[model samples]
Target: MTVFVDTSAFLAYLDRSDENHETAVATWTQLLHNRELLVCTNYILIESSALIQNRLGMAAIRDFQELFIPLLRIEWIDESVHQTGVAAWLAANRRRLSLVDVTSFETMRRLFINTAFAFDQHFVEQGFSCLK
Candidate 1:
């Protein structure tokens, strides 16, 4: 099975203080043990890296890059995906909804991925099944 990795999951897994940390760790371990295909957009990488660095410090960013990143099949967003994401973001018109989240939704739809390893309710609101 292919599971889309989101920034929420990354943060949760990396930050021990995060409320979702335990669940994230358990789910992540299961996914790795099952050898599930883990996927993510390049947008997620950028977002995660920045958050990790800001909240957890540079060492966490290193761990994110050297350890966690290798497990993901990154889907790089092009101009078309970016535009589509922007349109979705505008259409949603929700203040808290981010362009990255919309792009993730688009990426999942394009890849036919139904499951997401995420803590974000936006995924559930958008009708995608979230692992955590």
Candidate 2:
């Protein structure tokens, strides 16, 4: 089973101060060891880079890339995905979900994915099972 990894998981993995860091590391270790499938979207990739650079510095980001790059199967986000994200945002009744969340959801749906290594409650509320 492949999982759509979210930016939150990446942040946790990079930030030792985060309460969820261990969970993220443990989950990623399992994925990297061929115990499970791992997937990421362009949105998460870009977000992770920015976050890592800001919080942990470029050196740490490079370390993260070295560790995660070979194990992850990255999927690109496209124009149609943006349209779908906008539609989801506009149709929502009360939830204040962001385009990132919508993009993740759209990509997951398109890829026939049902789970994510996410700490975002929005993902779980929308029916995707989270790692924690």
Candidate 3:
């Protein structure tokens, strides 16, 4: 089964100080052992990249660029997907949910992916199975 990766999970995995770091690392290790097909949208990538760059500095960003990113299948969000996500976000009118999150939801739905390797509550609220 394909698993969608969220920014929260990426951040936790990269930052040792994060509260979820240990759990994320264990989950990641299990996924690696199982050879799960991980996937994520470009939106998620941008969010994670920016966060890592800001919090962990350029070295972390380089690690993401060279190591982590290549491990997953990227679901590039196109115009239609963007529009759909925008519509969903607007319709939901939830202050907590960002456009990127909605885009990830749309991407997951489009790809028929139901599981997420994430620490984000939004994914669980959206009915996607979250690993942690």
lDDT of 2 by residue, 48-125 (tens): 898899999998889878987677888888899988888888788456687778888988989989999988888988
lDDT-better candidate, 1 vs 3: 1
lDDT of 2: 0.85
**By TM-score, is 2 or 3 better?**
3
- Candidate 3 contains a number of clashing pairs equal to 0
**Per-candidate RMSD vs. true structure?**
0.6, 1.8, 0.8
Please write out the lDDT profile of model 1 over residues 11-122, one tens digit for every residue: 9999999999999999999999999999999999999998999999999999998989988899999999999999999998999999999999999999999999999999
Alpha-carbon runs more than 4 Å astray in model 1: none
Worst 10 residues of 1 by lDDT: 63-72
In candidate 3 the C-alpha lDDT for residue 88 amounts to 94
Better of 1 and 3 by TM-score: 1
How does candidate 3 fare on TM-score?
A: 0.97
Question: Once model 1 is optimally superposed onto the true structure by TM-score, how far is the C-alpha of residue 3 displaced, in angstroms?
Answer: 0.1
Native-vs-model 3 lDDT? 0.93
